[model samples]
Target: MTVKIAVLVSGRGSNLQAIIDSIERGYIKDAAVNLVISNKADAYALERARKHGINAVFLDPGRYDRSGYDRDILKLLNNYDVDLLLLAGYFRILGSEIIDAYRDRILNIHPSLLPAFKGLHAQRQAFEYGVKVAGCTVHYVDEGLDSGPIILQSCVQVLPDDTEETLTGRILEQEHIIYPEAVRLFAEGKLKVEGRKVRSLD
Candidate 1:
């Protein structure tokens, strides 16, 4: 049984590419990236999807209210028969319409070990806060801002001389690894969310 995936992005989608690569490499099985949706018209993710022969979609959020925009997106997701929604670099907070509709089926990868520096600029936030460790997390998206159940997290040490850019680079490396790992687990039916905790079963 292959899971139909719809990837949402807002910018250059390196993580989206990672997922595609993982799928192609057979690291993630029983899943196919059926569609790629971007809110920004100029997002490079759309081009990447087209290059790979996946359905690419662009929606102009400026044309509608937040509710209408998300409603249209929900319609597209339904039309494409998406089974899992992946947020690669999607910037907007998902509306309740979509969130409630997908629930745990919507997966997101954050740049930091969540419940820490959420919102935006998470790498800079950790560096400025003088944290000794920083990393990335893959989680289920809820209505709250990065307050959903965590699925997987990997950490990196903060070097004494690390700048924001250096730290971001390191964290992104882990993002590439863990995000694909998370998707693999999800595709394999190995992840379970019990309360606020997620268990990775073998």
Candidate 2:
């Protein structure tokens, strides 16, 4: 069974591209990205989706209240028959309606080893805090702020001469790596969430 994926993005979408490339290269078999949705009209992710012949949509948040906007998103997810929802650089928190609907089916990649620097500018926060190691996490998305079951994580060492930008870039590279691996695991039914832990049957 081919897994149909819908990705939510609010930025340049490097991780989105990584997922696409993995599917194309058969690194992730029996899966396809059917839709890419962005809240911002000018998000480069939309353009990336278009270039790949994927359905790209821009939902104007200003046109609806928070619940209403999420309702529209849920509608779209239904319309696309999305099997998995992936959040890659998406800025907004998901409402309970979608959360309850998707539950463990929703996946999010955050820029820090979560349960630490969450919310925003996580890489900068880690750098400022003088952490010796920083990394990214792929986890199930719950209603809380990055408080979810972790699926995969990879750490990057903080060098003495590393700037925030450099650290962020390295963390993002790891994001691109593990996010696709997590998606592949999900597609192949290799992941199981039990309470706060995600187990890999593979």
Candidate 3:
């Protein structure tokens, strides 16, 4: 069975493009990107999706409250019968309704190794904290902000002179790699979340 995936993005969607490329190259075994959703109408992600001939829609977050936004998102997901929801740089803090509706079906990629920097400016946070190691996290989306069950993480060493942009650039390379790997694991039924840990079954 092909796992139907819907990706939500609010930016350039480098991770989204990685997933799409992975599917095209058969790296993600039985997964298909059904649709791409963006809260900003001018998000470059939509253009990326259009270039790949994938269905893309923009739902204005400003028009709706949190509950209404979730309702709209849920409706869109159901319309496509999407089995998996991927958040790649999606900037909104999802409400409980969205989390409850999708439960374990929703996934997100955060820039910093989670539990360290839960909210925005993660790269900057890492730099400010003076952590030598920084990385990205792929996790199940939950009610808490970036406080979800961990799926996969890839670490990158922070150079002594690294700025936020430099650190983010390095982390993003790992993000492109691991995000697709995490999605592939979900599609193959290889990921099992227990407590705060995610076990990958071969």
User: lDDT tens string, model 2, 1-202?
Assistant: 8999999999899999999999999999999999999999999999999999999999999999999999999999999999999999999999999999998999999999988999899999999999999999999999899998999999999999999999999999999999999999999999999999999998
Considering summed lDDT, which 10 consecutive residues are worst modelled in model 3? 93-102
- In terms of lDDT, model 2 sits at 0.96
Tens-digit lDDT track of model 1 for 22-92: 99998899999999989999999999999899999999988999999999999999998988999998999
Task: Output the number of the lDDT-best candidate.
Answer: 2
Which residues of candidate 1, in runs, are more than 4 Å off?
Answer: none
Ranking by TM-score: 2, 1, 3
| Reference-based lDDT, residue 96, model 1 | 97
In order, the Cα lDDT scores of the candidates are 0.93, 0.96, 0.92
Q: Mark the 10 consecutive residues where model 1 has the least summed lDDT.
A: 179-188
Clashing pairs in 2: none
TM-score of each prediction: 0.98, 0.99, 0.97
**Candidate 1 clashing pairs?**
none
How far is each candidate from the true structure, as Cα RMSD in Å? 0.7, 0.5, 1.0
